[model samples]
Target: MATPADLPDSVYLEIFSYLSVRDRIRSSRVCRRWKRLVDDRRLWRHVDLTLYTMRPKVLWHLLRRYMASRLHSLRMGGYLLSGSQAPQLSPALLRALGQKCPNLTRLCLHVANLTMVPITSLPCTLRTLELHSCEISMAWLLREQDPTVLPQLECIVLDRVPAFRDEHLQGLTRFQALRSLVLGGTYRVTETGLESSLQELNYLQRLEVLGCTLSADSTLRSVSRHLRGVRKIRLTVGGLSAPGLAALERMPVLESLCLQGPLVTPEMPSPEEIVSSCLTMPKLRVLEVQGLGWEGQEAERVLCNGLPHCSVIVRPCPKVSMDWWM
Candidate 1:
């Protein structure tokens, strides 16, 4: 019988693949051979430090040790302590990351402060970028030179990022390859910004605009007119209008529609009107109405009865607490 130490490096690597990052790190301390196997570039392809709260310097040190050219995705979370300042991401650390991880494609930062960092500091190879409750500088996005913008970015998620505004929306039009976009808790975005952005993002397939002050003019008219190719859309806005509902019927490819937020108003459309609009949509498969009060359940019943093939969901709006940002 062969001893465990007799196992080949490939065998050790295969075993390491099944272990979590922390477990892999612990395994490295077993022996020199295991340490070397753990350091292999393949094992570091996707690094997630979302649960760890460390200083920027400490994170940089770890990245320098394990990060390799094979690294593609990185997820990090900043410390959100009460009355204590969170660790700031330094420009030097990002520059080094870009240089070391040339193939890095996905970058997710939660509760981070990127106010001092410029857009150019991010890896150019990134295809998916997510920033949740982050303080990103608006000027950082606008100031980037035309040549160095994230050219390959396909998906972007900005949730509860109070720093992002209308100008940032206009600036994001440069990313012509964008496919999926999620904007949540970004209250400042208005009809003008969204309309202009929608017109530019021709390739966008999925769009979610939550916690924004919008009405039929923004969600219905502009989106239906410009985003005819969009397959899925989630909008949190004010009461619906007749012309707006009519405009929504223009989308030839809409498969999923989610109307969220405190949408019950005096101008709110009736269950019959909404059900009539859904009947006209040939491709619509999923219809969800949240925060529409009593009408939501009524519409759900009507939708299920009318469109037997479609899925209908009705629910109250979720309450957002101030602590959620932290």
Candidate 2:
């Protein structure tokens, strides 16, 4: 009778594929054959090391061993401690990654220090890049001499990166294929910077600006004039006034609109004003109004009554603490 150890390598790999990263690591310690089977490149297509507490050297070794040409997505970040600083990502590691994972398409770095990494060190095949609470200068990536560095990049999300500013938006023009952009907690992006940046992106479809002061009539007018093809937009009421809201009429193809964040005490638009302004947008189908206080209900009613052809959703913003960022 054949024993379990006599099973073929393919069978062991099949079994290992069903295990979680932690479980797979545990299973690898079962025997030499199991370890070798676990090390197969096929089983490491998507690597996520966010949950593990690993040193930089250990992470580098793991990537070198398992990250073959087939790797598609890689998420690596350090856990936040009470008072201890997070570990910085090494330039050597990024250089090695660009060489080893040439085919990687998606890269997410959360709470990882990027001060040492160079923009050219990133793999050119990347399609989506997400940076959350990471320390790095946008100039490094945006100022690359070759505009074709991130040729296929479509989406970029920057959340709570204090160093990012309006000047960084200028760098985005280098990415011709960029379509969707999310900017959260970036207070430095002013109206002038935003208008100038939007002027260059004719293909931008989805845009979200949250927790920032970008509210200006001219800014929306600029958006209306430049981004006529925009399909989805999310912004705070404080960022847009009645005229600003009316400017959206220029985008006849807009499909969804979300208005969120705290209402500006005296400048908030009334329910009637909002309804009257939005009526001009012919293609709007989904409208979401959130984070407003008592007035949110009135706005919802007016939207439902005025725009029978569209779907309206209204909800208050959830309470978030500082720990939520972690």
Candidate 3:
């Protein structure tokens, strides 16, 4: 009887997928059959090496040889490519992966530092790209490349990263079919990228530009005109004023609004003012304004006097208390 290690390359790869990376790497050493199966580029569709804190050279070796054009998703540990000792993922490697893994759907990079190898041609079917604490350039983020390369690309989430410093929304025009996008901590996005990003949201239903700056006329006007598909908006501002709430008027379908900021004097709407102003929104079911605990006292009163038709839900410092108001 043929042992598991003695199976044909095709048959062994099926079982190989079930084995852990450490086990698979071990099994790759057993015999020629297992080695060939492990080396077979098709067997390595998803490369996630969170446990292997090995050298970048090892990671580079795996990506360079094993990952095929059909490779779909890639998740990696933190990468620190600097100094004299270690180098990050090479541009050649990235371009190779970009060429070979034309079917890549998701990429999650979790590291303190990384070398940004901007990909010119991404997989047409790529979706759900995530990066953490990596130093990527603006042109890379805002590349107006061919959409045929990334036709189905959508859902980009960045955390504590600086990819938006230069590019902002320049690259967003390429993703014509984008449905959901979260731009957290890409503060480099000034008014230029802000306007560019917002104006081209033909299919953007849920957009979260969390930490990008939009404190200018161009921003408010562009947002008012283009981001009219505003259903869920979370804004963290220096101060919240009547004019800010007035922006909600533009978002006719806005159901939830969260305004948060850190200042000695709270700058959020009083529960009364919020209920009164947002009374026109009969569909407005949820409104959260943190640090505005002062509003809790007069919330019901303002609702009864001003906008008596809709539910006036108000909570201040609820986030701190972890409160979920009824």
lDDT of 1 by residue, 1-326 (tens): 99998888888888898887778889999988888899899998988787777777767767778876878898887654423566667778877878888989999887877878888888888998889888887675562457557889888888888878888887777787788888887888887888887788767889887766666445778777788888998877575665577778747899998877585566666667777787888899998877777554555687678777788888787686322321
**Each candidate's lDDT (Cα)?**
0.78, 0.76, 0.60
Local error of candidate 2 at residue 246 (angstroms): 1.0
TM-score of every model?
Answer: 0.81, 0.81, 0.64
RMSD of candidate 1 to the true fold? 4.5
Off by over 4 Å in 2: 1-20, 27-45, 78-87, 216-218, 294-298, 318-326
Of candidate 3, the 10-residue stretch with the lowest lDDT total is 317-326
Candidates 1 and 2, the one with greater lDDT: 1
- Runs of candidate 3 exceeding 4 Å displacement: 1-52, 56-74, 81-84, 91-104, 112-116, 216-221, 263-266, 282-326
For candidate 1, the per-residue lDDT at 54 reads: 72
Error of 1 at 275 (Å): 2.6
- Tell me the tens digit of each residue's lDDT in model 3 across 1-326: 76754556667777888886778889888877677778776667787775556676776667666676747788766545444465455566556666777777887766534335654533445677676666765456555654465566667766667655535466766777676666666677776666666767745655554445555224445556787666665555544555656656636676666554433234455655666567665456666554544464655566546755444455454332111110
- For residue 55, model 1's alpha carbon misses the true position, in angstroms, by 2.6
